[model samples]
Target: MTPERREEPGRRKALAFTVLVHAGLIAALFLGVQWKRSQPDVVEVELWSSRPTPAMQPAPPPPPPEPEVKPEPKPEPKVEPPPPATPEIAIKEDKKKPEPKKPEPKPEPKPEPKKPEPKPEPKKPEPKPEAKTQPAPDFSEMLKRESSERTARTNAASAQQLANAARAESELRAAADKKGMQDYAAKIRGKVRGNIVLPQSIQGNPEAVFEVIQLPSGEVLSVTLKRSSGNPGLDAAIERAILKSSPLPKPDNPALYQRTLEIRYRPFEE
Candidate 1:
């Protein structure tokens, strides 16, 4: 059949469905209006009283009248009929056209045969030179030389170790002797310093140097002034203090004893 004739049936079905929907809407609106009008009106009231006082007796003569209310009629709900069933129209589909046939692929050419590779020539081996025969070494002579060399090295190392030990011993002894002498001199100075009486005329700080001779028993033999303090009175005081300090402290080590000693003194030695 023609396409125009096929479309005519679909159009008629659409028109019928639209008319039925309009009729349903109108019926719903009319029912809603009627229900609102039939509903009863409500009234609310509130009562208030003053503060309570003492109870008073009175004559019972009046009664409260009853309130008169009119009865309201209930609205009857309208029943809605079920909507008509929609008609399902049969849709006619057009036939599909046949697809064109694809062209066949051509066969690939066969690969050429591979040629055989030529082989390399084998190399000739060269003649080896004859080895010369050597005489065997004398193991006894070699061992004798090695033993002598080891003995010489051991002797040299021993001598060096002994020399180093001797040198270290001497250095330690010298240091101890020096320390003993310094402590002895300090003790002597302490004694002399305590006996010294400063002269009133001695103004600035002055340094004096004195050379003292002592016996091994620590007895002062004599005292000679090497550098003066530039003041005669101060010099006399220092000399008297030194003389009073006779029999000074002796050295702890006898090797640290000296016949003559150079003593330096400052008036204000902090």
Candidate 2:
């Protein structure tokens, strides 16, 4: 079938074209009427429908696929043989044969330890709790009390010893009177009281520390020097000092003193 052509479209030109085509058609119709007197009959035209064209064909199918192939198997790994054992040998000798010796392994050296030197055995210290709640007590008062008690005990003992010494002195005086040395001792005492003192280092006499006895009426008897102080000068000086204090001071102890006097001066008395 033939394709329909598109009309050139525009408003002002189509309107002018339509007006011209109508005028021409009207003039042609007038001419046709005039020509109709000279001619015969005229015919009309009719339009019919048209058929469409056939469709195009497609391409043919491709060839078939090829077959697949399988791969070959792999070979196995090989193994090694074990070592042969040593054979035993026979000997025909009188002497014994030695066996093979095995090698000895060297020992590893031991490490020197940085030991803490036993850390002084860690002196098992006291518990922390006991150290905390329980505080140390003051011993000052207790020490002072003990000191006072000790001093009091020492003073009492010293007083008792002094009393004992006084009693002993009394007994000694009585004994001297019985032995008739009291008056002599008294006169010697008066003479020695302030006049003489023995050497400080003198030693060795408890008795017979006397020399001569002089009566109160003024008579010098045999003078004996005993218990020498190991020093002739001191002994002589003591004698001189004693003689210089002669006619001994009268004794205030009347019962202990007498008319007959014994003079005694020992450089080593005490």
Candidate 3:
């Protein structure tokens, strides 16, 4: 059979199946025509295309910076050694010169004692006036009393003289008398006389006294007082009169002569 063109339904079916198959295979083998229809559009970026550009070209990382080493602080400038201390000069001990001993203090002079002021002498007491004394009454009464005593004394002496002279020879008696006479003349000195000063109150008293000085030859010397004047003037005159009458008669016996020669002057009872 050449296959007479006949139409079988099955075969048509078979033919349709074959055509669909071939067409499906042809559609799957498309030549780059992308026929995309109704799926939503989607965009996808590649990772390598979106990288950012750097602002500066980075240097390869430098070797790690060296760690800063701090240098130790320099030691403070060394202090210069102080100049060697000057050695204390040991001066040789000077021989101890002893200080001269202080001069001994001069002793102060003693102050002169002050003189005492002269005190006024007390005035002497004036003498008081003395009361007058009364003169003796009746000068002759005193004279007579004194004369009586005198005369008796003379008489006794006269007796003694006679007795003593009686034993001597006449030549011896004469020689003694002459010797006494010679002494009597020599007793007077200085002008013609000497006067015995008697108090005026006693001019009238007849009490008598005599001076009988012995010569070198032991002879009785002289006598002259007498009683003749009544006035004091005349009585005073009589005292002078006696000294002026130097020599007088001599006695034979020396004892009688010496004992009696104090011639008493009776000047008050004329």
Best by lDDT: 1
Residue 238, candidate 1: Cα error in Å is 1.6
Q: Give me the overall lDDT of model 2.
A: 0.36
Clashes of each: 0, 5, 5
In order, the Cα lDDT scores of the candidates are 0.46, 0.36, 0.32
Off by over 4 Å in 3: 1-169, 185-226, 240-257, 262-270
**TM accuracy, model 1:** 0.45
What are the per-residue Cα lDDT tens digits for candidate 2 across 14-128? Answer: 8999999999999998977773332211111000000000100100111011011001101100121110000000010000011010001111111111122222122122233
Model 2 lDDT, residue 103, Cα: 9
After the best TM-score superposition of candidate 1, give how far the Cα of residue 104 lies from its true spot, in angstroms.
99
Highest TM-score: give the candidate number.
1
By TM-score, highest first, what's the ranking? 1, 2, 3
**Candidate 3 backbone clash number:** 5
Residues 133-175, candidate 1, lDDT per residue (tens digit)? 1243446445544665565556555655555555565556545
TM-score per prediction, in order, is: 0.45, 0.24, 0.18
Model 2, residue 68: what's the lDDT? 12
